[model samples]
Target chain A: MSDDRIGVRKTYKLAIGGAFPRSESGRTYVVRAADGGFLANAARASRKDVRDAVVAARKAQVGWAAATAYNRGQVVYRIAEMLEDRRAQFVEAVEAGEGVDARAAGALVDAAVDRLVWYAGWADKVAQVAGSSNPVAGPYFNFSLPEPTGVVGIAAPQESSLLGLVSVVAPAIVTGNATVVVASELRPLPGVTLAEVLATSDLPGGVVNLLTGSLVEVGPVLAAHRDVDALDLCGVPAELVTELEQLAAGSVKRVLRPPAAALDWRERPTPHRMLAFVETKTVWHPVGV
Target chain B: MNWEYAPAPESRAIVDLQPSYGLFIDGEFVDPGDGSAFKTVNPATEEVLAEVAAAGPADVDRAVEAARRAQHETWGPMSGAERAKYLFRVARILQERSRELAVLESLDNGKPIRESRDIDVPLSAAYFFYYAGWADKLEYAGFGPSPQPIGVAGQIIPWNFPLLMAAWKLAPALAAGNTSVLKPAETTPLTALVLAEIFQEAGLPPGVVNVVTGAGATGAALVAHPGVAKIAFTGSTDVGKGIQRELAGTGKRLTLELGGKGANIVFEDAPLDQAIEGIVNGIYFNQGHVCCAGSRLLVQESIAELVVEKLKARLQTLRLGDPLDKNTDIGAINSPVQLEKITELAAAGVAEGAERWTSPCALPEHGFWFPPTIFTDVSPSHRIAREEIFGPVLSVLTFRTPEEAVMKANNTPYGLSAGIWTEKGSRILWMAQQLRAGVVWANTFNRFDPTSPFGGYRESGFGREGGRHGLEAYLDV
Candidate 1:
């Protein structure tokens, strides 16, 4: 197949902690486009992949969090720059796979990159707008601050693939969260490509892992998993939001529904830090001063 | 599961109007261990209904502890079948005394006796009967292999349909083997208090369904109470947001069923007479004290004039007088405050340039009554169109196409309910899909069933309250 117009082969694996690796299960599933074109035989991530992702997230979370907020912002901005450099490729690929015009494809990719820049700026500043010092009755000087909600399980949107996937992934990670996102079953090429970008970016391994497979087979596994802290169900099927909502409540994990089609995504307000996550800390001081 | 229709004769003696009251905690009624009594008025007659006990933080603590104790040893471990039996007994007793309860509801809630008898009372009994069946068949509810009760629930109901709202809150909680400390709305606490009596007569365990009569302070106390495991509230959007904010940090489980400025859209293809009737029932039902009331009418421009004309002619026949009278249709505005709100919003509509009209219905000199009112030439941004008046006032607006109707209907923040009056089945299906409201009533306005899910979206609040979905509020998955 390496003749004049034949295609070159490449290996597809799970993206974890900014690296590509084979599944621990050594299983694979063939991916096909809507037209029945063979895309690739991608590695099927196992439960072990979920555990490793959690461990990697736990490892990187402290360092990522301890870094100055401005520094994190700078790192996030760098990814946006990388996305901008590869803009034409994304536009071309989105048009080819999603069947949109070049102009719309370009706008889609640009919006995705712009969202990274937008939320990157929010990484440190959201706390200022969302939390405050409360005049709660009694005792010590009390204040509230937003904290990461740990590992989030995201079901990336099925259509408007590029921009939708970026919108969900950036918000979770920008707030110091790690994510294991299940790409769309019918349109996952953009997600897998975006994962390649993250693999080369500053995102720590396992901090953002991308998986491509059947959502019906995989969504319940992520939902019922005790280790998952929160869920961003952007692309979840309508018939299943309630069931997933019920399961996510087991640990009181914060669950956000997908925005409606008519919702003004560009104008929608960013949720306050305290609104999305909570921080509970215990401070011990001498009783007698 | 049996529903009986009985004429509820006018009665001013069932309710003993008093000056003030105290909290009902444990099994005794006491002045809030903190002295604050709220004024409760009969919505039908602008009369001071009673003084209700406003529970303070301390009282909330006591009530929560009592509920916890009750659930811990008394009610929690009871078999599902046993819970069902108690609910069945409660349902039977409610039916046996349906007329008295209906009269009490009409008096306190200000809904016409016809609705109180035919709609509210029967529906309340239906909720109890339906959930009673589910008490032993929870596995069939699709929860999972295992579903458990989320212990003590603090429920807050509204004044619209006092007894029905209480049944909505209590039946599911009790059927799921959960204890509740329920706070009835300050204006309509009698039926809920009577419901407590029914529980007592049915030999229900103490604290299984405690009624604490109070206003915002009491509701806040219950919602903020730490000992309570879950909080379920049915009220206004503003109060719902406050509760959501208060529960922000506590990680307390919550389910909110709040306000809705529902849109009842009528297309030219609709059955004109039936659509007009639906429009009347949509906004004028319970004198528009419903959270899901169709306060905004989006009439297709092709027949806008005809629909308004028909709607106006139908409004003339609606009787507005004593709520206890079986023939009364529109009845009285729930209270003076609600009437004032309706009057203020209606005046604001005229001030904002909407053509205002009212049916020539006479009001009693003693009660707080308002005629069924309509406003035309209303812009999408008019307060009468945008804001919730929560009374018998409808703002009329015109749309050109299906897309425009859907757009105008879903423009508001409240997504509780929408009514699509069209004979085209395909059009209703399409509109139902596009309109984002939780409940979509097609060719019908206020038709409700124990099997259908009902609630709101966005600011109208989260969580369903009826059918299989209602179990979510009481379940620990």
Candidate 2:
């Protein structure tokens, strides 16, 4: 006996303010598999979408950063767990997006999950490693601690679809900064799937708003937004990086320049990424009865 | 029952000023390539203190070359322990000549002798002492192992705290094993030049620290110099932004300490008397030229009227006179241009419908002066409340609760420093956490230490200037 059935496809949309909505411009672009096969259509985010995402991120930042470090760590760890549970879906997306073999795709997905876990562990320990209690030369008590730079704008890496996106987004959110991420233009399905994982993992909405579209269209808007405190240009095209950086300077936004050489996402990450988006605040009080 | 105090002026004989001064390059005083010169005047008396050489682009090039050579040949090759010794020697020399330096600072910069003698000179010396010890222990600074110096540093400082700002820039650069070409503000180059003599007396290596004096063009030349691996600046936000834009894609390291309009919040349950003293010190210190000066006072609504009345009475008692007078509390404005700017901003406050109260203080006969003034009924949108009025002017805004106070304090683009006055411990902690500023003072105001890191968030600028974090600015991390 022969059976015939139709497979239901997922409509990949931009995640803004906890809801998956189509682009405000009402546009969608076809995303192709690595072998040029037809894949799902992804939302083509516009400048309006960029502004909306920044607003959401700004609204979410105060509460997210106000959450206890331990609680934030738990929320981040839960993201890894949810991503782990949806491993096969990400493996399939990575294989299609990166044109890698099944084994390599599986390895990338696993690295993504482990990267989230690694960053989650840093949520509570970063202050200890980066902060200090100064023995000031005075009759006073002084100490410095790290606070999150609010509302970061991240351009996810274009090539390493899953692992690179995870690598950049995890460190930012783990340090308590809400992020408006511009996912890979050509390969965005894995990023959308990861957004779904974040949504279900108890992570607050607007904390991680993912947008899939043309970087050229939205990169400058994100860079020049006065409300955005920092920019991570890890995924911006080389030709456009300088322009985006110049725009970021208009507001004196803290900019993280992209690597000069090709980066290996599977390598062990450093604490530098987490420290990049944090501001050091020193407090002084008189030591007296 | 009017009583007057006698003038107790500090002796000027301690500073032996030269008729004309040249750029200090390669441990020697040399004439500028363009031979252009400018007169340094005492803002308090309008006397031409000295004729100083104005460095052009060519002179900036010479200074950068000298610093680069020094870094590669001497400073870099030396061990951290050896470097620490030189820094210690410089610190000792500064302390030994503290009186002369302080007197010169008061004459050239127009700040009171009391502040120059006690706050500026001592803090300058303390910075060298603090960073001198960190010279050898950088590996333990938690920036990974074997951090390397970032070649030559190009530093430009504002006129507000001339010598102290120089120390804030150079001590860390030198301690981190980097040579520097420093540019002092045009109006206040005397103290920095005097500091060069101290460096020479201490037997510091030639070109390890070079002083090039000029206006903005010379600073632009130094900033754009390709040989400089880092640029550290403390000035207005506008110029800092220009420099930040100019350095795009060049990959040179940059750190900025820029302008701020800090909010000093007062709670209802606070120690009222101490809070009054802190409120006065926060804004009037340094004649309000400080970058982190608490120019905005946020008093809770319940005590706002009482605090304003008390502040007015306290203002009347502040003596505004000659900077050399030991009894002077408020000194002359730094320059005529700054005085005019302050006048214009204060006028705007009046034009914008805020009530202004000027202290009953007589002005000096021949110098720039502005009385200690405060504006009540100041809305958050007022120009005097928002823009940095780097003069003896304070804007008073009232808040009803802690949340409203935090909201108003963090509303500005600049986040440099803030003050909180309350008797409650948990409230202080909570307020400190809510503020977006770099430095927070609880039950006190305008307190600084070499061991504390100082910088700003947002447009106020990035990177730190003191403590262990300051070393990162001069190192290739």
Candidate 3:
């Protein structure tokens, strides 16, 4: 069955508003394997692209958040199912981009799939864990519930492309926030492929917009975006964290700073990530017949 | 026939005024390192009550050092039960001295004596008592199995509810076993200084709680200090943003309870009399110095004119005069600076073409006073409807549908608090879910309890101040 045929290569593009399009700047950057072999050219997203993604995210946020929590859970779990189906493709991308052995890459892909399933379970349950029925000393029946912080801007981790990107994006969207994510600048193939999985998994368009570009250029624009209600700076460069934070302060965006020490992606995730971007809304009504 | 009631004044003799005061550091009243002093005046009469030390950077540093020492030596290593006892004592002492504290608070903060006596002072004591129980119950708080304190907390509170804000910040931090360096707002430092006396009478350990009184520069120094691990501030949105920016990469935990222009929505089906009372309490209480005051009134268009007419008639009954007068419904503005800001913003409302209707109450000549005002036909774009005037000014806007009401209510960057008046239970619940605010009250407004968590969303800032959720701010999760 060995025939002399050339295999078609996939064209890498930015995912914004559930559609794959070339960067508005019409720019592309070369992506190389660990051994410096040219893998492919990825769309180099510009500040304009960031702005478009934010608008898309804002547009989709209300609908996505309005969906029943159970429906959201199923949609997230569907993403896991789709990712599991494309495990081999992600393993190959991770292996090349991260300079890891096939087994290591496979393990990373498995963890990413499991992370999605883990977050899927939280979509419906997070409110119960994070919210409370306050016993106010009055005639009022008071209760507090967690609501999603509107549009979140995420900078995916520079290392551990697939797992780290999945780790950040899942917790954000599972809590019903629409996201504008800047993927791993050096190795964005796995992130874009993950976007493909998301697009087909019944996730709403614009719920998860992925961009591949320089974080230095895109980070500030995303941080400073007035439409963005929150930020996850897990992958922001150390030197730029303060500057980006200052920019984020202008709009009072809820910011999650990077860990002081490098995180091990293999560690079991905590609910803190999901809770960080939620606002606890307490409602009161008089207790009367 | 015209009838008038004689003035019923609350006795100022309840509070014993000191000629001069020093900063409370290391459980002692000490002079500021920089020998600078400022006079604190009673806003109702512009009478200089006492000369208070103005703490500088050196004082802030010393306070932080003392707090850090307390954390390491007395507070952190102590058992939760032992800590609970101290907090319990503090609560008891607060309740015992509440009358004196309330009188001083009214004098310094320019709030009505009724509010200071009934709401602010009692709530301060209630906060201490509530957190006192939580001191020994950390494991059940759900943060973790053995949550640790986040070292010294630098607490900066606004002047609006001076002693109550102090209680909101310190009770939780201390109950969680952290030491504190508190910066009381410059205009209202008297009650907090008296609170220091209560802490001493409770036999609290030296350096456990330090009070530094100064202006913005001292607060800036306290915020920038390296030894502080957490910062809990309640103030304007602009200053909150500045503090957030300053602590950018410092790894310090922060919780801010900032400003808001809350909306109070009234539907046609609402109980008319009760809704009118709620509307008055929502904005006119505390002279509208409250951060979560319902400054924006969103009424059902069918009843908008009726509501405004009733509101105007009700405003005329509000007595605006001396804070010590028990019958007075509205008090003096906190300071000349705050009065000027309110006047400027109210003028902007009139200039922006909103119809302003001010009450005909006679303002006292010697004090800072602004008549209770209402602006009808206020567009969402009007400055009065958008910005936090922090005075007795209410903006009235009408909407035809529930959806429009929700949309107009959430139009601002602030999401601190809101109120809904409707007899229908389902609509109340639906509006509560739709409005993007931290606290939503149905059939009531400006109601607070120690067990109820209070905070805000969006640009109004983050973190709850009361109940179980407040423990997370002081704990290292």
Task: Give the RMSD in angstroms, all C-alphas superposed, for model 1.
Answer: 18.8
Candidate 3 regions exceeding 4 Å error are A1-3, B1-3
Query: Native contact fraction of candidate 1?
Result: 0.00
Tens-place lDDT digits, model 1, residues B161-239: 8999899999999888899999888788888877877888898887777778777788888887888989998988777
> Scoring each candidate complex against the real one, what DockQ results?
0.03, 0.80, 0.80
lDDT: the better of candidates 1 and 2 = 2
Scanning candidate 2 chain B in windows of ten residues, the lowest lDDT window is: B1-10
TM-score of each: 0.66, 0.98, 0.99
Residue B177 error, candidate 2, Å: 1.6
Candidate 3 - CAPRI tier? Answer: high
What's the C-alpha lDDT at position A111 in model 1?
A: 85
- Give the runs in model 2 whose Cα sits over 4 Å from its true position: A1-4, B1-3
